[model samples]
Target: MHNPRSDKPVLVGVESLDNVQQLVRTAGDLADLGAGTVRVVTVAVKRSDSPFRVFSDETIVREFADSSHELLDRATTPEGVTIERDVLVARSAARGLLAAVEETDPAALVVGWRPQEQRTDAVFGTTVDALVERAPCDLYVERVGHEANGVDSILLPVAGGPHVETAARAAIAIAARNDARVLVFSVETSGDAAALAAEGREALAGVDGPEVPVETTVRESDDVTGAIVDEAAAHDVVVMGATRKGSLRRKLVGSVPRRVVDQTDRTVILARSGDVVGGPLHELGRLLRRW
Candidate 1:
């Protein structure tokens, strides 16, 4: 199915001018995915001497905003994409982006994902973790350094869930833009390789439009993450769906996508198709409905 939100505006959080190239490239990819406009946002704090200070660092902030737009004009805004610039002066990057999201409810919020020393507590970086938990819209965390190579070869892994269609739709849109191919990989299940292959093909067929070439593979592996990581090395990017609703499944088998993020060298996109739920409270609703 085509993404319902693809034609909506996209909100991108610009970390800095250094990341302008990649950020713009991602915005273009979103355009191919059906985004009508890209709103580039940045955050800066104003310096103030005291409550009596009438002229806060308004000049400095204005200069920053001007420079930001210049950078976007030079490198970020592509030929056919409508671009909007926004600067928010907030305490932190997360707060600034959240403010922008509140003001302009974009279809998806795109942010950079930098690899950092693994903290024992958080699987993703601080900003991403915070946004994933609370963002009002779908979130796309683009891993830096793995710039898409014309979307030449895209990797999408699916076992069985809601995210399968979501990820497939994204891959199809991206591939359609670059005239690329999509490889859909799935771990062996049901102890039947042929059956798995058949199922995988059917799933791919359901999502695969005439826009791009798509292929499917099913392999047996106890280490699901290892298999995906190994396959990801040869692909331009890996798009995986978030399984936020299945806590029981996560507790039992762990999160394959989280592990894949840590091990893969290629760009990883954690695509969420809908609004984030209110954690345990959301789960409670599901339980109550079962009664």
Candidate 2:
């Protein structure tokens, strides 16, 4: 629990009870990786002034104290891993989280999203949708039901974008930490596996830690969603871009993200423009704030 910031402590913001468990589970995976330690930060942003509110800045600080103590008491939290966690109160939770990213300077931020109960919210959760638009650090938006600890295998589909490399960097860092190999696939009519592998190797070239094995695959079909859905089942997580193309069309033609969320048991990560170092990932950024 030393706190000058180890290799890269994860900054996680959770809003739901479900997210709390998800964050805890993911934190364990991050700790196991030795990429650094995983710290949990649960945040609540309020729209109305209600005393029922527990996320006030001071209140959060106090609650974080209790939560951390309770968290430590449990056998689930690894004994040796460092835990520097907090509860934050902010006018806008997402903005506060991004600010924390700047202030705490974690390598990246992990966010949990359980698709909205209704059809529209399924498109995106309001708060999660906002963080994608504004978060400063790399973001990994995870869906529920991810009970696994290590991301032994991953699928990062290079759906063309300015922030594509951002996703690659995030994936590389993750793979390096977990001692996992990444299968980089881009849904395309034609793409060179050798070339894609080279790109993945290049993207991960300078990151800290041991080398991460990389594989490249290109799937063909008019259906982007089908390709992603099929491959994701075999992997632990899927990091893919969400295009701004008509939702109905993508859904009908196949939205890789929508289907992945709908069909898989694995965690699905949505990376936006600011996260990736390059611009390809920025392609999905366009969808972040749109209606």
Highest lDDT scorer: 1
Worst 10 residues of 1 by lDDT: 245-254
Candidate number with greatest TM-score: 1
Give candidate 1 regions above 4 Å deviation.
Answer: 5-7, 45-61, 118-120, 189-210, 244-254, 278-291
What does candidate 2's lDDT look like per residue over 1-291, in tens digits?
111223667777766554565565555544544545766766556556755364546765675567665554441444455666666666677766866775777656777777655677435665666666556655667776564566788788765544455566556655765678888886665655446545544554544435678888876677766777888888877776555455432331125566667777777776554433325454455356343
What TM-score against the true fold does each predicted structure earn? 0.78, 0.72
lDDT of all the models against the reference?
0.67, 0.61
How good is model 1 by TM-score?
0.78
Give candidate 2 misplaced runs (Cα > 4 Å).
1-8, 16-18, 24-37, 44-47, 52-60, 72-81, 149-151, 173-179, 190-198, 241-255, 273-291
